[model samples]
Target chain A: MQDARIRLFSFVSLSIATFLSVPGAVLSLGWLLLSPGTLRETMKSAAFWVILLFVTIIATATQMSGNDGLSYFIRTGVIILLGFSVYREWHPGEYLDLSVWLFGKKAGFDIGLAVEMSIQGLHEASREFARIRSALSLKGLQPGIRLIPAVGFLMIHTRLMRARDQADLLATRGYRAGGSCCPVFRTSNRDITMGILAILVVFLSFMPVRDIFILQM
Target chain B: MKLSLSAVEWNAGSWKFRADETFTPGVHLVSGRVGSGKTTLALLSARLLQPDAGAVEYEDIRSRTLSFQYPEYHITGSTLHEEAESYGVNPSAACARAGLAGRWDEDPFRLSRGELKLFQLSCLFMRQWDLLILDEPFSALDCRGKLAVCRSIGENRSGIVLVSTHEQHILPKTDYLWEMRTGKLTFRGPLPEAITAWESAPGPVRMLREQGVIPANLTRDDILEAVCRMHE
Candidate 1:
């Protein structure tokens, strides 16, 4: 969605609906399918597969323990899909614009700046991981189970160092919390449509399955 | 030992790179503008990346390595000692070689960028690789670090050393020249003769070529000698 506020609103509502019932998850899956390429793009990430594998293991364990694991699997998987779309659609300054538009200058700007920095940090960490892996391969070190701890340590250490550097830069620039910003948004009719649908889905999720079918008819 | 690219093609989204060249022993300086696929070429040459078509073949090249553009990317350890050991080099020896002696306990990230770069290069140069690909090795270095790198490149006598850089002034004596134009790797042939055909030649080299004098090599001394000869 072009409008960050609407996109976030839809995401939150859809996540809540998806978590409530199997029918809500089914509905959320339909919403996810509307994007078409989000699933494909999310699938391209190795991290996605790793997360899915972990979820699968937990779900399997739950099933073996006589719980409704299938429902849990569907809900979590759809939530992940929705989350990926939000991430993929995010522009650098969208959060700042939305926050400022919603909460005004001082408080919103500070919160928005923190969120922006955190998101950027995530991107930098991902890039760092790729470069570190390449470095390992160049050094004739193969990636296996044994190197996971070391790799994780390196990744976390670098991220913390980078965060510290960013903090220093902000301090040097005399930034003490709030900043001035003119918020702007370029929202489309489709964004509004999807947003309304998200709210409707939440309301429908709470209704009886028979009532939803009757209402549909 | 040799590294060869035969009709190799790699695609990254809309950008495409194609190369059909063979690199034999001695220093081959690959020069190109930024975003001209120099790093991609280095990675493909190092076999870190598989081409979408054709192949990159290594003939008798048992040991090989690729030095990344940013020195920070290669760091896997917290301290200088661990970093050296990560490269499988002795910590004290590598530290001393990089002029970081007695500072093995220092964090690798705490070192100045130039120091980190020198340290990384020093660790890599300690081993003899049949093929060594240095991608923008002089990027974060000072003049002294650049000279040290050039000196090390000069000392590698029996390997295919592919130095991909746009470094204009300081350079080791090179064997062949290649240029990456757009996304294609074009061979400019052996040096001296290749100097005339180097479309993206460095400023000094181009100036010397404009005066109808091609240096025997691309080193600082070679260009100065050529200039003196031009006056003579």
Candidate 2:
């Protein structure tokens, strides 16, 4: 969705619906597939698969005890896919706009700024990880379990130092709590259509299995 | 020892880089504008990046290391001592050489950007490598640090040292010169002659060249000598 407000709304609504039932997740997945490169990008992310594998392992353990772990896996997977889609469409200030519009200037701006910095930090961490891996290889060291502590330490230390610097920069630039900002949003008809579809998926999830089938028939 | 890039091509989205060159001994200064694929060349030469087309071949060359542009990216150590140790150099000596004496126990991240840069370069320069690709060695370093790095480059008379930077002044006496035009690596040949044809030659060098005086090398002393000769 072009509009941050509508996109966040649909994302939250879809997540709740997907968590409610299997049908909701299936519908949400189908809805997500409509977005251009969501499936391809999500599939390409090693992080996505790693989390999925971890979830799968847990779900398998649950399944061994004769529990309905398959449904849980499906719901979680769909939610992850939805999250990735949201991330793909994210611009720099979208969250700030959404938050400031939702909450008042002071609290919303603080929350939004925190979220923005966190996201920026994540981006930096990924780039730093690549450079660190390169540095390791240059030093004739392979990235293995033994090296995780050193690597993790470097990454965390770097991020913390950067955050400190950023705080200092903000202070030097005369920044204090509750700065003035006017949030603007642009929405397309397609955004509204998809948002409505998200709501419909939620309602569909609430229906009984037989009733859903009957309605479809 | 020789390092060669044979028809090497790397594609990043819409941007493309192609390099076909060979480096053999002495210091080779790679100059280019910002975003001119200098770092990409350094990475490729260091074998950190695999070319899309040809190959980066090394002959009778064993040890190789690439000093990244951002010195902070090289901090694999919590303390200055450990940071130097990570590079297999003596901690105290490296710290002292980088002018961070008695700060061995200090966190590497606590050092200013320039100090960290000088520290990283000092550690890297401590070891002899067959191929040492330094991308922007002078960046973040003050005049003294730059001169120290230039001196280090001057001292390393052996091996293929690819120093890619756009520092306007205070350069080491370079042996060979090369430039990155757009995405293509163009060899400017050996130093003295290369100075005339160097299109992206630094401002001082360009001015001297415009006045019909070509420096013996891209160094402050050489440029001064050339200007004196011009006056004569």
Candidate 3:
């Protein structure tokens, strides 16, 4: 959805549904799959399969042989798919705009700025990890348990240095505790339809659908 | 021994880099503007990054090291002493050589960026490598620190050292020069020839050429001597 508010609302409503009811969770996944190209992109990630396998293993070990195990696996899959869908559509700028629109300019701006910085820090950390890994490889050292401390220290050190520089820049720019930003949003008919569907899914989760919804194990 | 790229093509995000050049056993200075793929070429030469289409061949190379643009990325030590020791070099000696004699016991993360670079350089210099790639090594250093690094580079005769930088004025005495323009290796030749032939030579070189004085060498000292003689 182009509208940040609608997207956030839909994500939150779907998250609640996934946690509450199996049918609701399945509906949430279906809604997530409504976005074109999401399913293909999600399936392409090896991480998604790994996580699914891990959850399946846990379910098999704990429940052994029963409908409960199968249900657990299905629920876990639904949750994972919901998360993947949310991440695929995540936009830092939209989050910032939504935050600023919801909260007053000052407090909302601070929160939004923090979110933006966190996203940027994630990118930097990934790049830094690659560089550090390459450096260690060049030194004839394999990345094992021992390298964790060094990598962690370097990442923390870099973040601290960046924070210091950012502080200096903020000071130089005469930044106050609360800054203001103009919040703008554009909503479409599709966004409104998705938002209503998300609300309906959350509402459906509260209804007792044990008689109607059944999964053969 | 030589480190050469053969029609190597690499991509960084949306930008594409192509390099086809050979670096001999000498101080080779790779100069280019920002985002001109100098670092990408340096990484490829160091074998840290593989090319998408071609090969980076190392002729009879036993060991190699790549010092990244940010020195902190190369640091894996907790303390200054341990940082040097991690490279299998004497901590005290490396610290002293890096002009960080009294800071051995301190956390390396506490030191300034330039000091960290000096410390890393000292450790790298202590070991023998067939290929040394320094990417923007002159950055975040004082004049004396820069001079110290230049002296180290000038004194070394062990292996092929590739210095990738955009700093034109404070460059070391390089034997050969390579210029990257818009992701293409545009020039590769002797230093003197590069200074005279390169259309986008540094300000000092262009100024000297404009004044009808071309130095016999491309080092700062040689240029200064030539300019002094011109005045005399």
Candidate 4:
């Protein structure tokens, strides 16, 4: 996973497999769980459980039957796990390096810069959330429904200001929509093997494995 | 009351900060250039951020409030009335104090940035805090608003107040001074001593000192009085 290219390839392959086949998605979830500390970290987040519960409730409310609800829950859960696993492995900078390596420097740099900004935005959003929470605590107020609007407005305003500043900085630095970078990669043999395996898994997901197994029996 | 940092070390992104100093009761002005870890130190004093190494200890101080550089981040109410009343104060009085008296029913989000900052500052002043850490409180305020904030800090005689700002001019009467340089507490002592000791002291202070007009204190009024006396 050191090389962004192989890691991205594997992530794409797994995503395709998860979307195409239920069994393949389940298998991928199991594979992702093998990564050390993944399950522990995922479980520790209260937001993860709250989101999962919310999704389950919505699925149950909208589904035609019990089986449909169950299927929806499982599918969503697997996708979430897959996303978490991918995010855990990939650093934001790697996206830029990989893009520059794959495409011509100009187009690649633009895409990479976009990706970098998105990641930075997310980080700033989280930090802002913490600051808001602390502020509320200091004022002897708990974060309740009434506080949501204020929090949202503040977050948006700050984000807009930050975006404007970043734009100015980029302009001052003579950054165009496109720029060049020398892409370097440090992919190991294991990463290559994993990338190949991921592609094979995607291909296999398209086959009727249950039917094949039944026929052999 | 006293707030002390014992061999405190913290890292935020690429910046690393280390401090080992004690702060006594009164207005402590922490001045530094932008990105010199001033905000980091303020957060540390407020216990919003824990040091990677070392500790921050408070003596006879239980409650603390930290006002972020951006006042919008501290807003917790939907309307001006609600925000004004957030700190257990009379809504009408607080709104009047913040210069939003007639606009109480309006959403705080509808106000301009400077208005919102005034509202937040009004709420902050309403509460009794053992430690008050205001990071760049002067930003986004008009001259009148700035003067009001400085007066409020000067009047508050109960708690340990730490003001971290880049604005050397227009600060409240500071009892102690601390300077952050390159992620380190390069200077800490009485304000007058810091003014004399700080090699990169602000322009006005340096100019006065060069003219042999050392003020009795580091306040706008004190410095102005000294300069006027020198001219006379």
- What ranking of all candidate models by lDDT puts the best one first? 2, 1, 3, 4
On the 0 to 100 scale, the lDDT of residue B72 in model 2 is: 76
- DockQ agreement of candidate 1 with the native complex: 0.46
TM-score of every prediction relative to native: 0.86, 0.86, 0.82, 0.75
Error of 4 at A68 (Å): 11
lDDT for each residue of candidate 2 in B1-232, tens digit (9 for 90 to 100) = 9999999999976899999889999999999999999999999999998899999999999889999998877777779998898899999999999998899999987888999999999998899988898999999999999999999988876988999998998899999999998889999999799998898989989888888998888777898999898887
Which has the better lDDT: candidate 1, or candidate 4? 1
Give TM-scores of the second chain, every candidate. Answer: 0.97, 0.98, 0.95, 0.94
Cα lDDT of model 4 by residue, A1-217, tens digit? 5777877777777887877777667766765655556566666556678878887897887685545766677767777766666665657688788778777788888988888788779768878888888888877777888778777888998899899999999999999778867777897987787777787778777888775366653
In model 2, pairs of residues that clash are: none
Q: Candidate 4 — which pairs collide?
A: none
Candidate 4 TM-score, C-alpha based: 0.75
Q: Whose DockQ is greatest here?
A: 3
Q: Model 3: per-residue lDDT, tens digit, B1-232? A: 9887999999855789998878778898888898888888878888888799999998998888888889888777788887787788999999999988878998887888899898899898888778988999889988888888888888765689888888766778888888888898865578676677766677888888888887766667888887897787
- What are the runs in model 4 whose C-alpha is more than 4 Å off? A1-3, A16-49, A52-82, A85-114, A156-217, B6-17, B50-55, B182-187, B206-214, B225-232
Instruction: Output DockQ, candidate 4.
Output: 0.61
Computed on C-alpha atoms, the DockQ of candidate 3 is: 0.62
Give Cα distance to truth, residue B162, candidate 4, Å. Answer: 1.1
